[model samples]
Target: MSKRLANTLGIILALLWIFPVYWMVNTAFLPASQSRSTTPTFVPFGGDFSAFSRVLTPSFMNSLFLSLRVTLLVVVVALIFAFLAALAVSRFRFAGRKGFILTILIVQMIPAEALFISQYKMLQGWGLLNSVAGLSLLYVAAVLPFTVWMLRGFVDGIPADLEQAAMIDGCSRTSAFFRITFPLLAPGLVASGVYAFLQAWNEFTLATVIMNPSTKTLPLWLRGLAIQSNQATDWPGVMAGSVLVALPVIIFFMLVQGRMTSGLVSGAVKG
Candidate 1:
């Protein structure tokens, strides 16, 4: 294809992806009557913040905070565990190491839906249901295997020579790794962290099964909003809720997107 044509196609694809988000924002600002009117208003000229105000009431804010707590916990725990496990498998050749790597793959192969019953029961037995810790722990387990494997690839791609060079210059093994290889792994870490964050933030089925009404997360709260609306569905409120839920993800991407593309592998020798 011609360069111009390819560029056009890419722009078109990008617009297609962004249209839904635009629609959500459009609806969020629209008046309730305009939303349900026979003639749909594509643009919001005099946007009202009433729906947004209602969605931000204390109950909804509580769910938002709860979701944030779970997502943060998931990201931190999953990244730590993935990092150490990736380092071990990539740096060492201990017995059962190969099997351990394979097991990560196998564990990911098992569909999450299939394990919901057992997962719920296990948490219930441990008295973890409807709790932030319980939900975060489950999120970690859900995202860990794939994240570890992904980080392992990035780690394996980093030549050991850099760390060795640092060690020869009198740096301790830990310092050598921290000063040398860790910088190179930053992109992979950000990518993996984004994945874990999105999973924990957006996952509904597992959260629905585990969390109670009182401890609802954002997605769960959104679902409840949908059901509660009944005949007079609060499209504006729902869209407002969506925007609120999406803000963190968008801000996060903007923050890390630069690092994901630059500096992460800036000084690293790839093997």
Candidate 2:
């Protein structure tokens, strides 16, 4: 295709992808009747803030905090474990190392649904049901395998010679790593973090089985809002709730948007 044609196609695809998000924001502010109307209001020129006002209940705050806890826990715990495991497998030679890598792949292949019953029992045995810690554990496990696999690629891309060269100049092994190798891994860490955040934040099915009504995540809370609407589903309210749910992810991607694409090997030495 010609350059002009390619640019035209790209713009078309971009607009297509963004239309749903545009509709969502448009619906979020529309009055109830307008939102449910047969004729669509594309711009929602006379949008109402009532749906947004109704969305900020005490329960919404509770679920927001609960979700924040789970996401924070998953990101921190998964990164720490995954970084270490990836470093080990990438830099060291050990018995069962191949098996360990194989296990991560195998775990990823197993459908999460298959583990729900057993996971629930395991959490129940540990008295973790209805607790943020319990739910966070599951999220960590769910994201950890992929996190490790991804970080391993980053680790492999970074040459061990960088650390060794620093050590040759009188720095201790640990010191060289902290000064040289570690700094280059920033992009990878941020990338891994984004994936983990998105997974834990938007997760619904696992939350449905693992968390009861007493413990609510943003996804669960949004569902309850719809269910509570009863005879007349509050389209505006549901749209508002969806926008609320998506804000964090959007804000986060904006903040780290540059670093994510800077590439894992960008800063690393070729050797």
Top candidate by lDDT:
2
Residue 32 displacement (Å), model 1: 2.0
Indicate the worst ten consecutive residues by lDDT in candidate 2: 262-271
Write model 1 residue lDDT over 78-194, tens digit each, in one string: 999999999999999999998997787677766768889999999999999999998888789888887787788889999999999999999999999899999999988988898
Model 2 CA deviation exceeding 4 Å by range: 1-17, 253-271
Model 1 residue runs over 4 Å out of place are 1-17, 251-271
lDDT tens digits, residues 14-125, model 2? 9999999998899999988887777899998899898999888898999999999899999999999999999999999999999998888778767778888998999899
lDDT of 2 at 125: 92
Query: What overall lDDT, based on C-alpha atoms, would model 1 receive against the true structure?
Result: 0.85
TM-score for candidate 2, please give it.
0.87
Candidate 2's displacement at residue 138, Å, is 1.1
Q: Hey, what RMSD does candidate 1 come out at?
A: 5.1
lDDT of each: 0.85, 0.86
For residue 31, give model 1's deviation from the true position in Å.
Answer: 1.9
Total backbone clashes of candidate 1, pairs 3 or more residues apart or in separate chains: 0
